[model samples]
Target: MQVSIVGSGYVGTTIAACFADLGHEVVNIDIDEDIVETINSGTPPIHEDGLPELVGKHAGQDGTGRLRATTDYDSIFATDATFLCLPTPQADDGSIDLSVMETGATQLGKTLEATEDWHTVVVKSTVIPGTTEDVITPILEEESEKTAGEHFGVGMNPEFLREGTAVHDFLNPDKIVLGADDDRALADMHDIFEPLVTKSDAPVVEPDTRTAEMIKYANNSFLAAKVSLINDIGNICKEYGIDAYEVADAIGLDDRISEQFLRSGVGWGGSCFGKDVAAISAAAREREYDPAMLRAAVEVNDRQPNRLLSLMDDHVDVSGERVAVLGLAFKPGTDDIRNSRAIPVIEGLQERNADIVAYDPVAAENMRERYPNISYASNPAAVLDGAAAALIVTDWEEITELDAEFDAMTTPVVIDGRRAIDRRDGIVYEGLTW
Candidate 1:
């Protein structure tokens, strides 16, 4: 299969490299010349675990000529299928802003007008239900001046790749969804994922386009709710002075309540969960339904950072003190700082007049954009030195190994948001919901 992916962002770049590695000739199209050049040069434009190696092997000058990138939308005519991997950023009121997706689809349709063979345009970006049929399909049809089923097929295939382990998740998925109304479009989707399905022995889900879109939202919303529910339970356990981890471990034995997302802590903060939950909630409200439970989940997530900071305040008055914030990325393994809990933690620290020093292995430069005046240390040890108190926001692997660094703190007061660190003898350590 010859596949072309538009918008060389995180999802677009990742899938293009993976597809080429899966024995398909792939081309990545992006408006950004730097991203196209980076992909063509065999270096990934984004940082993901195991992605650089895969991109280097399949694309670029030093590897197999199976993958390449271009800035021209006309290259879509050369491929059998094109996946719209553009970003659907959230609007101010929580509705999805589809301007990017619309623009990309129009450009793709205009390019496809030159091709005579039938091509499948798969919606790979996460969207609300009815977006593929109501929003994207009409634009593609108008721009191409051709009927959808006869000239070009439309499909909705949502990606379930996590940021940290996207490559592994792609190669070994639990399920593969192929959503299409037309038979040929469904077949094209199956063909694209055939190798992954066979290798991973993953179950294939065939549903309609709307159902597919709903699945992405429902899946993420459920996970977000689950975490909030656990955090709620963890908060109760903390009131009773019970160990949340111990309770989580015992409850995980039941098949009904699995251990995944059970580590009740400072709540989830990332691109997917908050955005998807808000979008679905807004969609439901538009339909005259109030999603009370989902809104409560959001409330719980919003309050977690404050609760962690309050615990820090219980031990020491951070005003006019040096505070060390460990970790800035949402999760370990990636540099993405969007919706990271560290943002609120830093804000809370600043409100108390605390001099902040933060450290993350890869996220410092990105976080610098958000708080330009705050000091960033090259390593965790540097942040701890001369600091009065420390707050652990992200569970980076290196943070768990710190033992001697705590001794350097002026007060040695520690607050663990993610339970990433173990309690030591000298420091006054507190877990947010232990």
Candidate 2:
């Protein structure tokens, strides 16, 4: 299969690499010349596990000629399918702002107008229900001046790739969803993922386009709400001086709950949960339905940072003192800080007039761009030296394995937001929810 991927961002770049690795010829289309050149030169533009090796293997520089990149939509005419991976950022009203998707659709439609060959367009980016049909299909039809099912097939194929393990997840998905009204589009989608399904033996789910779109929202919202529910229970456990993890462990034995998201820590902060929940909640309101559980979940997650800070406040006054912040990325195994819990922790430290030093194995530089004035340490030990207190935001392995670093702190008061530290002698340890 010859595949063309639009928008060489995280999802786009990752799937392109995965497809090419599965023996499909792939062409990545992007507006940025630097990104295009980087891909063609066999280098990945982003930081993800197993990405560099894939790019090095199939990106055409080594003469395998399985993968390449271009800046022109003209490349789409040559491929059997094009996956729309454009960004659908949150609007001011909490719905998805489709301006980027619209622009990409317009360009794609214009490029299709020049060719008579049949092509399938799959929406890979996350969007609310009715977006692909009510919003995007009309734009593509108007620009191309062609009937959708007859000339170009439209489909919705939601990606379930998690950050930090995107490649592994895509290659080994638990399910593959193929959503399309047109039979040809659905067939093409099956052809696109046949290699993966054969490789991983993952189940295939076929539904209408709208249901597929809602599936993504439903999946994310449930996990987000589950985390929030556990966090609430953990808060209660903390109030009663009970161990939350022990409670979580006991309840996890129930097969009904399954216990995937029972780790109640400083709450979830990443590209997916907050935006997807807000979008779904806002969409429900637009339809005149109130989503109470979703709203409560968001409220619980939003209050977690303040609770972690309050725990720190219980120990020592941080004003005019050095406070070590141990982790910046939203979660470990990646260097993304889009909605990291560390952001609010740092801001809280600033409000208390505490001088902050932070450390992460790969995310310190990224966080530095957002906060240039804070001191970034070369190692986790560097952040703890002579610090009055330390606040743990992300559960990076370096911070989790710290058994004696508390001795270096001026005040051995450690606030554990992610349960990254153990309770021991000679130091006061506080878990965010324990």
* Per-candidate local distance difference test: 0.93, 0.93
Candidate 1 colliding pairs, count: 0
Residue 235, model 2: lDDT of 98
TM-score of 2: 0.99
TM-score of each: 0.99, 0.99
After the best TM-score superposition of candidate 2, give how far the Cα of residue 6 lies from its true spot, in angstroms: 0.3
RMSD of each: 0.7, 0.9
Residue-wise C-alpha lDDT for candidate 2, range 1-434, written one tens digit per residue: 99999999889999999999999999999999999999999988888899999998998559377889999899987899999999998888888889999999999989888989999999999999999999889888988999899999999999998888999999999999999989999999999899999999999999989999999999999999999999999999999999999999999999999778999999998889989999999999999999999999999998999999999999899999999999999999889898899999999999999999999999999999999999999998889999989999999888899978789999999999888888999998999887
- Please provide, for model 1 over 1-434, each residue's C-alpha lDDT reduced to its tens digit, 9 standing for 90 to 100: 99999978889988999999899999999999988898899999888999999989988889898889999988888888999999999999999999999999988888877888899999999999999999899998999898888898999999998988989988888888999979999999999999989889999999999999999999999999999999999999999999999999999989999989999999898799999999999999999999999999999999999999999999999898999999999999899999999999999999999999999999999999989999999999999999989999999989988989899999999999988888879999999888
